[model samples]
Target: MTDIALVRVTFDTAAEADRIARHAIGERLAACVNIDRPCTSIFRWRDVVETAEEVTATFKTTITLASALAERIAALHRYDQPVIESWPVAVDTAVAQWIDDATHA
Candidate 1:
């Protein structure tokens, strides 16, 4: 098994999600990005409660690339404060190797 970084982000549109995914993969920041189903999010921003439909994205990359991946996502995100989070994850040997290959360039 290998340790990798699992990054999760939300976008207002599928286009936005796809754009981020493409950029991450193109830049070798992430090995793969899995676009998940749309979800409803409720939060408080600027003293106002807001609700919106959001698309979730899951990114796979080496732990070493997590910071850069998050930075890239923030740069490409449209939201004033995009939701970007990552944590270390353990994966099967083959999957880990694949991630390293995909992100290490």
Candidate 2:
């Protein structure tokens, strides 16, 4: 069975996002990566509240590869605590097959 998943991550800069995306593709961790424009993120770090501009990237991969993709992203990320999440998505059969074919566990 083919299962599709989306791995979402945020980076400090666009370059970082691109770098990670390239690495993921090269390593067969993700089928495709969509890099979004800069977005403002607000959160609390430690004892203080903070806000910063970040670039978000969504990795199209298979359910089997989602964990490995997230691990790779964390290893290559520069942030002390990077936002890396994976969610199962219901996609068309064709898309699910495509992702499964592209991603390697």
Candidate 3:
């Protein structure tokens, strides 16, 4: 495994997803972000089960930047509890090099 992670975050809207993506890339916290369109989300909120449409943003970056990226996303997220998850990325030389180049640029 590489010292990198793939961060997954879901937002209430496309605008929200775009905002987080731009901020993360602009801050060098992420090398790139892929935004997925609105999709159905089923979860419990405030003791009530609910379903809502949401957009998902997946970010690629080093583990060292994960905390800062999460903090920034939380600060800008509209939801009281945003979906922010990170998973370790298995190393792939080409992809890892691209990530390093993008974040360092």
lDDT of the candidates, in the order given? 0.95, 0.91, 0.86
Model 2 off-target regions past 4 Å? Answer: none
- Give the per-residue lDDT of model 3 (tens digit) for 9-77: 988888878987998899888999999988899999899999998888899998777777888889989
- lDDT for model 3, please: 0.86
- Ordering by TM-score: 1, 2, 3
Ranking by lDDT: 1, 2, 3
Candidate 2 lDDT, 1-89, residue by residue in tens: 44588999999999999999999999998999999999999999998999999999999998888998899999999999898988998
Candidate 1 off by > 4 Å: none
Window of ten residues with lowest summed lDDT in model 2: 96-105
Q: Which stretches of candidate 3 lie over 4 Å from their true place?
A: 1-3
| TM-score of candidate 1 to 2 decimals | 0.97
The residue-level lDDT of candidate 3 at 3 comes to 62
